[model samples]
Target: MAVTTAPDRAATPVRAPAHRVRRRPTAWIFAGPAAALFALFFAYPLGASLLQSFTAEDAGSTRWVGLDQYRRMIDDPVFLKSLVNTGAILIVQVPVMIGLALVLAVLLNQSWLRFRGTWRALYFLPAVTTLVAYAVVFQVLLKTDGGLVNQMLGGVGIGEIDWLNSPTWARISLILSLTWRWTGYNTVILLAGLQAIGKEQYEAAAIDGAGTLSTYARVILPQLRPIVLFCVITSTIGTLQLFDENYVLTKGGPDDATLTPVLYLYRIGFQQFDFGYAAAIAWVVVLLIAAVSALQYLAFGRERRR
Candidate 1:
């Protein structure tokens, strides 16, 4: 029979190893200040905004009014108009820009292309350009009289356009400016995705006698779906949050044509001193962004499974 034995504790006191706290605490020590700052700045403001959205101010005192502010959005014409305007941009601009970006990405990925870095940089420049300055420059270029765009049109025997003054044109101008600024950024991003794919995929497709367009349509672009989804979702968010371009170019326009939710939020908060209503609008925007992003993710997931 095998004998099992336990150490006799009566012989000597068993000293427990000093239960020193793990050295891993150094990481938390370093991260503590950053966490504190984030809570102070981002988390606190975010919580405050959500709380503020539920209350209204009167006689310089805030009072809780629950969903009344959100309900007000339903009957608010300007708010509805802003939503419609943002939706229009989302529908029209996002796809067009993504498509253009895909084409540029493909072109950039071509082995025959020269100075690829230079081309990429040139395209990305607009995305990083000073926002207000770029908008001002567009405003100058788009002026109805003695403007560069009008001068060019006159040379082509076309009449001057009141780009910022007309509702339709104002929206169009915003779209054009947005496309100009962002297309290259999306192109660079998509190009990175394309480069991640192996060249053998292309070779295999070519060996199967697939034409260039057919191969990309049936094979390469499908593989790029995730990157394209990212671009689309981001662009959609940008469209929804549009303020700087429209604000500087047209100040929400001659007839509120370019009014975006963020611009409306600014007006309500700063201009009208209706901070609660502004907070409500902001939360609505946040919910919208979350909902739209979730839908896109689910959709992309389903499509990819196929």
Candidate 2:
């Protein structure tokens, strides 16, 4: 009995000092600031936006109107046009930009490529350039009459294009501008993912008589799945919220062909002072983005798990 009692006492845990044993308080101290910041910045604004979306503007006073604003949004032809344009951007521009970025990243990752650092710096320059600067520069360059781009085209016997004043041309111009600005950023991100892939895999593929294209398609692409998914989701959301370029360059002009949800929302809230309708539009845009992002995650996340 004494021997058994001694073994049991030794097996029991002994309480240590608070400084030596306690981890809960230290964790809370480290996490408290970030938790408070998130609540103030993200959580509060989201709640406010959702609430405001359900309200109405009556003689400068906001009154709760339930789903009237939402129903109005469903009937707004202008909003529908903006949504269509935003969808066009996603369907067209995002893939082009990402594809170009992948090609550039592969070329830059080559050990034998000369002046690689300089090339990378040149490519990445536009991403760090101010948004306003890019808009202003492109606006000048792409001017329909006596512009640099048209002048160059004329040298090859092509006539001047009314880039911003024409509906099709305006959409094309925005897409090209966005691609040029963001492709470099995507390239840098893809390059980081490419670098993380093991050199051994490439060597092994080469030993098996695989060429560069074959190796990239089979090995490199598979490893880049996560990075590609991330880029797709981010670019989708950004394109859906398209506003700045349309505002600065076209003002959703050429008969509203270039209008985006965000631009429409801005016009309603800030320009017209119809905060209730704008809030409703903003919420609709958010829901669209969330739905698309969720779909992408579900598709990619399932593939990753397998």
Candidate 3:
């Protein structure tokens, strides 16, 4: 047969496998645009902001001042007040919201709970609501004269108190609004963590003669450390970055009572046109967030090595 006279192996021209194409160029082809965009937008802006922070504008000219901007923050009363306000919210609002969320989570996780999905959605609605609309509604509700909240208080014989005008009441209003908006979100997260735990563990605790509250405190909550830590860390960070709610509601205040770092940054950068100082403040906030988040991780992330 003619097949018996097949061409010699070496003499047969080698055809490179079609599938053996170089992949490196293809990867770069896909990644090059994204890389370029990131460099242009994120990287350039970050480096520029950092460089600008070390320089001060003099006689309409930029001159390097080397830490002068950072030093300014130390003695700036508005800046210090902003820090204090942020700290207060971090300490008070975060714990209260988290505690309420934990309670709601446990209650919502109960097997007897009716229309659980509906309840969960209802609770979470505030989180997904339009920010502008939410802000406007809150403004109307918190208005000093003839507001919804004031009218309600008046009906109850509680004299009309300025909800958003007085510094103390403004802070309180901010905290209450923050809690109202975020507590449900945290509740959903904690509830997810609770549900992930099987009923078998609950039964195991029951067999060990543990009461319901003790069961949760001793058995369940211990396992939920990671989730709780997540909530706390996020809430802490959010408090640090607080601006929108305070801005929309109080414009950072009657007396800067709710003026957070970011809102302060806005004022410094935009209103005052002190971009270098603002950049310094921004970097400080970034560092503070990193430090606080690390500390919280160490504090709440502890677990027995198993």
Candidate 4:
């Protein structure tokens, strides 16, 4: 009764193709608009910028000039200064801002922390604040005489400081402004990373005689590696291409001390109408960012491996 003939057994029916059940043509129809917009706005601009680097102009008329504009960039002193300033920001500001953000994120993500929503809102306020408004407000606050910053210093018996007038101080002021503006954004990212961590893992660590410091160092940090790398890479790129704050706050002033690469590029292309040179600068910035991103990936990849 249990034995069936081999010929009586049949194979399972073939399933229909995945595409037969769902229409891919309809999906593409929806994606077409976004793809077109991206190609036109992002891809086109990047390609044009690259091509324009080799383009030349005769009294506001553009023409091809091969690599002449790039060659000129090699010897431009202001270009060199801008490079130095941008490099300085990447080296100093990026780490400081990211570190501050990480700390803030841990604090905000703490389970025992009270009024978490209110605190997060306060910290994240600067991020959503208009860049132009912040720049204008800071400019007024940093004024040498009768400004909020100087007035606060006067209360502490410290003399008024010319924050935007002095070269070193102006650079510091720019760095501070950049840090204040972006740290919250990074904190939000890192907090999300912290929240995504498994609660059971953390609890188990505590049960195994792990203190707060040990839990954070061993369990939390290792899990957060990817997010930290993301913040570092993005922050590095942003700092390298710093423009808006410097343009509005200092106008790349105080003897070009705070002049960033992008600011210099703007001055060349828009202010001086040197489109070729600006494109060259833009290309160099792209290369620099790529190199830095690669180095960071390598370094962090190795760290993760260990």
lDDT per residue (tens digit) for residues 213-300 in model 1: 9999998989899999999999988888999999999999778889999999999999999999999999999999999999999999
For all candidates in order, the CA lDDT equals: 0.93, 0.92, 0.91, 0.91
lDDT by residue for model 3 (40-145), tens: 9999999999999999897799999999999999989999999999998889999999999999999888879999999899988998986667877888998889
**Could you report the Cα RMSD, in angstroms, for every candidate shown?**
3.7, 2.5, 5.5, 3.4
- Model 2 Cα displacement at 218 (Å)? 1.1
Worst 10 residues of 3 by lDDT: 297-306
lDDT (Cα, 0-100) at 172 in candidate 4: 87
lDDT tens digits by residue: candidate 2, 91-166: 9999999999999999999999999999999999999998888998899999988889999999999999999999
Model 1: pairs clashing at backbone N, Cα or C within 3 Å: none
Instruction: State each candidate's clash count.
Output: 0, 0, 0, 1
**Best model number under lDDT:** 1
List candidate 4 stretches off by more than 4 Å. 1-28
- Which 10 consecutive residues of model 2 have the lowest summed lDDT? 1-10
Sorting all predicted structures by TM-score, with the top scorer first, yields: 1, 2, 3, 4
Which is the better candidate, 1 or 4, if ranked by TM-score? 1
Q: Is candidate 2 or candidate 4 better by lDDT?
A: 2
Residue 136 displacement (Å), model 2? 1.1
Clashes of 1: 0
Q: How high a TM-score does candidate 3 get?
A: 0.90
Off by over 4 Å in 1: 1-20
